[model samples]
Target: MPSDVSRSSARPGGSATDLAAVWAVFTDMYEAYLAGDRARIDAHLDPEATVWDSATPQLLLGKPALDQVRAQRPAAERAGGGPVEAGLTAYDQVIDVFGELAVCRHWLRIDYRDRPSGLLRNTAVLRRAHGGWLITHLHEDGQAAD
Candidate 1:
């Protein structure tokens, strides 16, 4: 996490603190993606993590599947003749923490290749394990591009 980012007032075991931590993790994950640092992204994902993205019909299950997709990212980015610029901005975020589990819901605007790709509503479930927060499941619904 960036040292400059403001810390939430919520305590470690409290929902607010957990929510802030989740947001920090989310930010770090995307920053890693933008930098093409798959290892960093992988570090934040649980072994049995799953994801459903708007671009694919099949569900992504486990690290292997996720890694396969990430492996292709470089080739895909080459289409843009360099690193693809990507970012995720979240809104209407709601977070709930239950012990070591946390669920976050938010509306997101994702930009890819320097332009807005889509608006998505997402729910991500994370668990605190291996001494840090790791994403366990993610479900995303595609919305009309804005």
Candidate 2:
């Protein structure tokens, strides 16, 4: 279980509402990814967002890189096929906001029905725009799941 469900910020200018919304952006994006909802996932991503995923070899930037990764999903998945079911959970979340920018760091555990679960050490940088938040950058490294 994650402690980020509740927000109590000690940093100046970082409010509970901001913390919750920032955390929500992380969860919301993963939920969309698991559900194969590309539109929803893109909704949370900044137009110029960059991501270094747990399995990727190089940093991915902008729309072209994003599209190429989507096209290369087959290479990343199982030889037979993809996961039949999967559940994503997070813990040890630290969310902070400074004006229009926020940083969210968390341990993400992804449980697959038959495949080995993946643990992600992730940091997401988000920018608040038009009353909402979009992921500006994401850095992630894979770890052995216990």
Give the number of the best model, judged by lDDT.
2
For residues 33-99, write the lDDT of model 2, one tens digit per residue.
7777889989999989999976678899986898888777785463436665478887777777888
- TM values, all candidates: 0.76, 0.87
Q: In model 2, which residue pairs have backbone atoms overlapping below 3 Å?
A: none
Write out the backbone clash pairs for model 1: none
State the local distance difference test value for candidate 2: 0.81
lDDT of each: 0.72, 0.81
Over 1-146, each residue of candidate 1 has an lDDT whose tens digit, in order, gives 23222333222345655667787777787678667687888888888899896656779999888667756666646455643456666666666777888877767777777555778888889998865689999888999986
What's model 1's lDDT at 118? 74
Q: Where does candidate 2 stray beyond 4 Å?
A: 1-4, 7-13, 75-80
Error of 1 at 48 (Å): 1.2
